[model samples]
Structures are given as C-alpha cells and as structure tokens.
Target chain A: MEKKDTFIKAIQENERLIFKVASFYTDSKDDRDDLVQDIIYNLWKSFDTFQQRSSFSTWMYRVAMNVAILHLKQRKRKVPAVPIDLGALNFAETGFDGNEEKLQVLRKLMNDLNLFDKGILMLYLEDKSHTEIAEIIGISKSNVGTKLSRIKQKLRQQVNNQNQKTAWN
Target chain B: MELDELKSNWENSNNRPANQNSLTAKMIDQMIQTKYDAKLNKIRYPEIGGGLVCAIAIVFIACNFNQLDTAVTRSTGAIAILLLILLPILSFLSLSKLNFESAVSESHVQVLQQFAIDRLRFQRYQKMNVTLCYLLMVAIIILLPKFFYGKDLVINKAFWTFAFSFGYIFLLVFSRLMSRYYGRSLNQAEELIREIKETTANS
Candidate 1:
C-alpha cells in the first residue's frame, strides 16, 4: 500500500482513541486540537520505526500518549494556566454521546489530579491492562495499580464533597 | 461516579465519527514543516541580533581608526578590531551546532530529558554571550581613550584609573546577576528532568 493511504487508514481506524487521549491532556478545545495535531504529526514521523512489535493499536497508544504528555509539559512551561473556554468545550463532541454532564464532571475531577495521576486515570478509564498501561506510561505495573487506586479514591472523595455541598446549598 | 461505572461510560464513548477527514496528510506535512521552520528561526533570531551589534561596533571602530599613534594605542586598536570580527563569528558557529532536529520516535522521558539538556545548553550560551559582550564593551571603553587622547591620559591618569576600576566592578556585579537569572532557568529544567525520572522509574 502507498504510505499516505496506509497512514490515513490507520488514523481513521484510531481517531476516537487519539481524540480521547488528547482531550485528557488538554482542557480547551483549541489546545486539544493542537495536541491531536501534534500526536498525528509525531505518529506519521515515527511510523517508519513501528517495527510491528505490538499491535498497531497498541503502538498508536504509545505514540499518542507520549505526544500528549510532552505537549502538556511544554504548555505548562509556557503558560502556567491553560486558557480554556468552558463554553467552547460544550461544542466539541467528546464521543461520550449522551453523558455530557458526566464528561464535564469527569473533566473537572481530572483537573484536580497531577500530571502523573492524570495519565494513570486516563489509561485506567480506557480499560487497559495494568501491564499495557505500564508499558505505555513507562512505569511499573504495580505502580500503575497503586496510582490508579489512589486516583479513584481521590475522585470518590471529590464527588462526595460535591454532593455534600449540593445538599448544604 | 465510581471507577467501574466510569469505565463503562468510557468504553461506550468510542462511538465517534469513523472518518479521517479532520486532519489530512497535507496538514500533517505542513505541521512538520512548520515545526522545523520555527526551530531554525529561533536560532536565526539570535544570530541576527549578534550580527547587528557586530556591525555597529565595526562602524564605530572604523570611524575612530585615525586616533592610533603610540604602540599602546596601536595594540589596543588591534585588539578592538580583532574582537569586532571574532564575536559574531563565534556566536554563529556555536549556534549552528544547536540546530538539533527533535525526533518524534523518542519516548516522552527521552524527549523531556533531551529538552532539559538542550535548554540548559542554550541558556548557558546566552549567558556567555551576554558576559562576553559586556566585557568587550568594558575593554573598549578603557582602551579607547588611550588611543584617541594619549596626551590627556598622562594628565588624568587617576581619572582613567577610576573609570577602569568602576567598569570592572560593574562587569563583575552585572555578570553575577545575569548568571543568577540563567541559573534559575537551568534549575527549572533540572527539576523537570528529576520529575520525569521519578515518575517513570520502575521503583
């Protein structure tokens, strides 16, 4: 197959996964779009070195996740606060279908986590195996489990606190 | 929501449009080109700034070349002329080595580590450039009078001595201040590297 044909096919097959990864790393639609473009750019650059050691989807996960994390770090260095239009987020479809409220609250919860925990939570939410998450994130499997458990606990506490505030209000 | 419930929502969320129309191959190629262009332009800006300063110094020296008479004045003029040629050439050579193309195949940790190293290298080069220019200015100021007015120097030896002393003190203090500023950036890069290592390490 031609390179462009294969590249487009791969991206078409994995756009949703890539979109989720980019959205997890960036809060604003503009930033998310930039991150996605960067991920695609990096993927195309590294495609020749894919070597097919793992499944193509797995390779996509590795490349997309790494690009997202690097983008996040560079943005953090450039601007401490990511300028996000809360309303603009409402326009972009997160692929969550009818669960817009859930997605919003989840994004809020994610904002409370540090960069490392955010990666763990993103991978965990994808239902990836601990070993797979570890490989993608370059951390130990046990560390992934430990961090995921802690992240879940943190999310539960935040939800509970929100519920308390609603009841009081 | 609970963890299990969130997983179900996430898995169900994969029903995005299955077309690859958003970012085309042409767009990707453009992004790659823009990325390198931006990198090269970064190095070019500094080179241009250094070149301008060099040009101005050469013009100033050329207009004042007739003042050299004694051996002391002649040697000072020669040193000034040498620096007028040397500074920009050295800056361009060092900056040429720093046009490193970032590889997309590298891992996140590898990329971050390389970024920290490259940034530190660039910052150090900037610090050195600033210091060298300041010292060169001081040297010229101290020597220029001896070339242009050697007779006045004998009558006002104390005044020239005082000016040189003040200039050296200013150079020392200003260079320290500049180093501190650059040092903070280097420290920030080092801290970032440490954070990446800690997060990625198996332990």
Candidate 2:
C-alpha cells in the first residue's frame, strides 16, 4: 500500500512529462490517452525495481519513451502516420499561440525524428541539460551535444529555406 | 517563429495542447484493470486448456493401471505421473521467464535486449520440450510389446503402418509450424535490437 501511494505521488508530480511523451508519440487523442495509460501501468508494475538510480522523472521518461516507441512501431504496421521533424518548422520571430496550425506543425516535426533523437529533442524542449538528456537516454554527453548541434542546424536550414520562398513570392 | 521563441511559447502553453484531458487515479486504475484482464485472458485460456488435458490423461492412465498388470504397465504409469508433473512445470517456467509486463518500465533498447534474450531462451526450451515428448512417445511404443510379453497381443500390420505414418506426418507438420512461429519472432527481435543499436551508436 505504501509503495502504491509513493508511485501515485510520483506520477502526480510528473504527469505533465507523461502527457508530453504521449503527445509526442501519438497524433490522436485516443492514441495519446492509451499511451499514457500504458505508461502508468508499466510504471506501476515495475515500481519495485525502480531503485532511484536516477531521478523518478528521468526514469519515467525512459519508460515512457520505450513504451511510446514500441507502440508506434507496432501501430505503423496497421496505419500510416507521419513522423514529425521540428528541424523543418519555421518558428515565427514572434511565436504563434499554441494554435491549431502551430500544433500541427509541431506534431509533424516530432514525427520526423527517430526514437532516439525524439527522446533527445523532448528533453531539449523541456530545457533539460545535455548531461540529463544523455543520462536518461543512455547516450554519452558528447554525443548529445553533437546531435543537438546537428538538429539546430537542420532547423536553421529549414527556416532559411522558408525565408527564401517568402522573399521569392 | 524562432526556435528560442518557440521554447517560450511551449513553456507558456500550459504544459500541453489545449484540449488535453486530465487523468485521475480512478481512470488510470480502470485502464490498468483492462490491460490486466486482457493479459490474463491471453495466459488463462491456453494454460487452463493444457492443464485440463494433462489432468484427464493422468486420470485415465491411473484408472487403467490395474487392468494392465505388468512391470511395463507399472513403469508406464510412473512415466505418466512424471509427465503430469514435469511437462506443466516446464511450461510454467517458460511462461514465467517472459516479462511482457515489465517491458514498459525498461528503456527501449534495454527492453528489446531483454525480450530477445527471453525469447531465445523460450524457443530453445520449447524445442527441447518437443524433442522430449517425441522420445517419450517412442519409448511408450517400444515398451508396449514388453507389456504383452506373456500374453498373446494381436495387432494388425496394416493398422500399425497407417497409425505410424499418420503420427509421423502430424509430428512433422507440428514441428514445422512451431519452428516457423519462433523463427519469425526471433527475426523481429533481432531487427529491433539492431535498429536500436544503430540509432544510439555514436557516428
């Protein structure tokens, strides 16, 4: 009972992170809900084995990312869904509200990244440090730095291309 | 919007999409219960069916033990009892080793690795189990003649030939199906593991 209470408390604290993961992986509300539920169940099931080697949120991200990726992989066989790549989006200098168009663009960008990169990007978006991202995804800190640089470059290129198109018009 | 500007909006966007629904403990519990019931259904039907078959076989053999009063018959009954205990234990061990539930807590790569290892172990266990069953069947066939050593047991050659042919064909097909099933699963696991390795590997 005590353990269950602890697990619930941890989840309550980090519910937003769980929601972020589910939203990143899935497009539809139904899918997102299912992903969140699945992640929670998994967290509950393995609550005992979580020895706090890392922070609970970090561990939760690890678990959530795994479940989401696997779920996406399996679902891919049945329905075709776009991968989002944030690198390709043109963020307005004055960012748009979390409007429908912005959300759609964000979703598409998320779809384009592979699972590992997706994990890194999710952490990056959350303002997590390179070291923390590396620790969560089991990658080296240097690699995380390199990947983030490359990703930023990609985003820059996309933004430049969009600018060129607007100038031409 | 600039990436940095997007970050501010993201943080200010109330943590998620506007329509995002809040989840409660009750809702989560319901979802967990649904998943648990589904998993239970997956294991329950096959396991219970297998258990029932084994129970019936053991009971039938025990009831007929007195009718066939021979050292060979007694040994056959002993073998039946052994199988009644051994086969289920083997099945249970194989099933228990698979941690589908725990995969949720592991990282993607770690889960794939663990699942691949568990699957390979299970496939090997299943193959050994099939071989043991075939050997036991052959042993029973060979020992039946011994049970009829002092008595005159009439058997038709044609019936024996047909029975052996049918049994062999069935065993061959069953073995092939099992091989194919395990082979496909192993391939999938291997591919997933390789993909994860590649994704995480430093360039």
Candidate 3:
C-alpha cells in the first residue's frame, strides 16, 4: 500500500510528461487516453525496477518513450476499459492554452519525423540536455547533438517554406 | 517554428498549473489493480472459453466416434479432434511469447530492436495461425453435419460446390482483411527499424 502511494505520488508529479508523450504519439482522444493508460500501466509495472541512477522524470521519460514506440506502432489491442474517470482527468490538455496555433504547427512538424527523431525532438523541446537526452535515448551524447542539429535543420527548412508561402499569399 | 523558438513557447505555455483533478489514492489503486488483474488478461478469458468449448467438442466427438461410419467423417473426425487438442496449445504458446513485463526496464534502443525481432516472430505466428485457421475451418465444416445430424455432407456433390464457393470466399475475405490490417502495422515497424538503423550507423 505504501509502495502504491509512492508510485501514485510520482505519477501525479510527472503526469504532464506522460501526457505530453501520449499526445505526441496519438491524434485522437481515444488513442491518447489509451496511450496514457498504457504509459501509466507500464510505468507502474516497471516501477520496481527503477534504481534511480537518474532523476525519476528522466527514467520515467525513457520508459514512456520505450513503451510508446513498441506500443503505438504495434497493433492496438483494445483492453477492457477500466472504470477510471478519464473524462474528469484532463491530463493531456498540456496547459498550452494560449498557443494553440503554435502548438499545432509544432505538432505538425513533430508528426512528420519518425519515432526515433520525434523522441529526440521531444527531449529537445523539453530542454533536456544533450547528455541527459543521450542517457535517456541510449545514444552517445555526440549522436544526440548530431540528431538535434539535423532535426533543427529540417524544421528550419520547413518553417522557411511555410513563411515563404505565407508571404506570397 | 524553429526548434529554439518552439522550445521557448512550449516551456512558457506548459507553465500553467497542473489539472485540478489529481488522482486520489483510490483512483490509482483501481487503475493499477485493473491492470494487475489483466496480467493474465484479455486472452486468458478467451483461452478459458476456448478450452471449455474444445473440451465439449472433443467429448461430443469421442462419444459419437463409433457412429462415424463414412470415410470422410472418420478422417475429418480425427482431424477435428486433433485440432481441438492442438489449437489451444498453439494459442497458449504463441501468446506466451508476448510478455511486456521487462519492456520498460530496457533502454529505448534495446526495446525497439527487440520489438522488431519480436514483431517479425509475431507476424510469422499470425500467418501460421491464419493458415491453421483455414484448415480448422475446413475440418469443422466437413464435420459439422455429422455433429448436428448424422449426415455425411462430404459425400454430397452439392455440399462441395456450396461449401467451397461460399466457405473459401468467406475465409479468404476475412483473412485478406486481417492481412491488410497487420500489413500496415508491419510496414510502419519496418520503416521505423530502417530509420533507426540509419541513425545508429551514422551516429
């Protein structure tokens, strides 16, 4: 019971990160809820194995991304719905209320990247250091740096194209 | 739109307070317990259901074993009994390989790499299952008449025409639908693996 309490506290603390990852992976609300539930469940299951060499959030993000890649890309097997009040818990709303347009554009660009690069981009956007990003993603720090630069370049070109088109209009 | 600009915007916008509906201990317990019960989970229900059905089927087939007078019935009865015995074992074995208990403990690269191999193996098993199902469908159809009314439909010429035309087409369409569904996921995984491999090599 105490362990469960600890786990719940940890989850509530980092729930935003979980929702952020879930929203990045899924488009529809149903899929988002399912993914969030999955991330939470996986985190709970792997909770015992967490040795805490890193921050809890960092470890949690690793687990979240790992599950998301193997999960969201795999065939979605619908599990029985739990009776949790998912409707009441607007976790993935992200508090990005005023920047809907910017959020949409960021999401559009993020969606275009593959899962691997998206993970990198997500970590980058979260302002994760190259070292921490490398640690979480299991790449060398140099690789994290290299991937981020390439992703940035891709985003730059995309933004420039969008801007040019807008200017022409 | 640039990474830095978006990063700053995201950081700023994400600063709004967390939702008021923070989960209570009771809610957390329920959520976790729901999955805990599911540790044996969705397939377990079907497995139990299937095992009982198979048991009943095998019992019915055995009880009437002496009455299977025709060659097709006898041969297909044997096949159906074999199927009843083997299908459950096959399902249990295939599903047993899909454990995700240790997934979150592994690194992202390791997880994806293992997932690629596991997905291929799972795809192969699915293909085998579809083929086995085709055979099971045939065997069950051949034997249903015997089970219900002691008639040997295999001996009837019309039975073959009707069963093959309709049965094969039904199975074909169902299998095609399943294949297309899984094929999309397979393509996604394959593409992901390719891109990850390229990134790994370049890095």
Q: Which candidate is the best by lDDT?
A: 3
Task: Flag regions of model 2 displaced more than 4 Å.
Answer: A76-98, A161-169, B14-22, B42-99, B108-203
DockQ (CA atoms), all models? 0.23, 0.17, 0.47
Across B1-203, the per-residue lDDT of candidate 1 in tens digits comes to 88888778777773343454454555555655555454344435556887898788778777766665556555666777777677787676544432222444555446556656666676777776676777677657656666556552534779678877887788789878887888777887776667667766755
Second chain TM-score per prediction? 0.61, 0.59, 0.76
Q: Rank the candidates by lDDT, best first.
A: 3, 1, 2
Give the Å error, residue B194, model 3: 3.5
lDDT (Cα, tens digit) per residue for candidate 2, span B1-203: 45565566566554353332244455556655666665455544555677787787678666656656556557766776676667766776765543556666665556555655666666777877776677567545644554445331224576468758977997899889888978876676565466556656753
lDDT of 1 at B45: 57
Q: After superposition, how far is residue B95 of candidate 1 from its true place, in Å?
A: 5.3
Residue-wise lDDT of candidate 1 within A89-159, one digit each (tens)?
Answer: 23355657776887778778877765556666777888889988876766777877777887789889999
Q: Pick the candidate with the highest DockQ.
A: 3
Ordered list by TM-score, greatest first: 3, 1, 2
In order, the candidates keep a fraction of the true contacts of: 0.25, 0.24, 0.54
The digit string of per-residue lDDT tens for model 3 on A66-87 reads: 8777665443555655656666
Worst 10 residues of 3 chain B by lDDT: B14-23
Candidate 3's displacement at residue A13, Å, is: 4.9
| lDDT of prediction 2 | 0.64
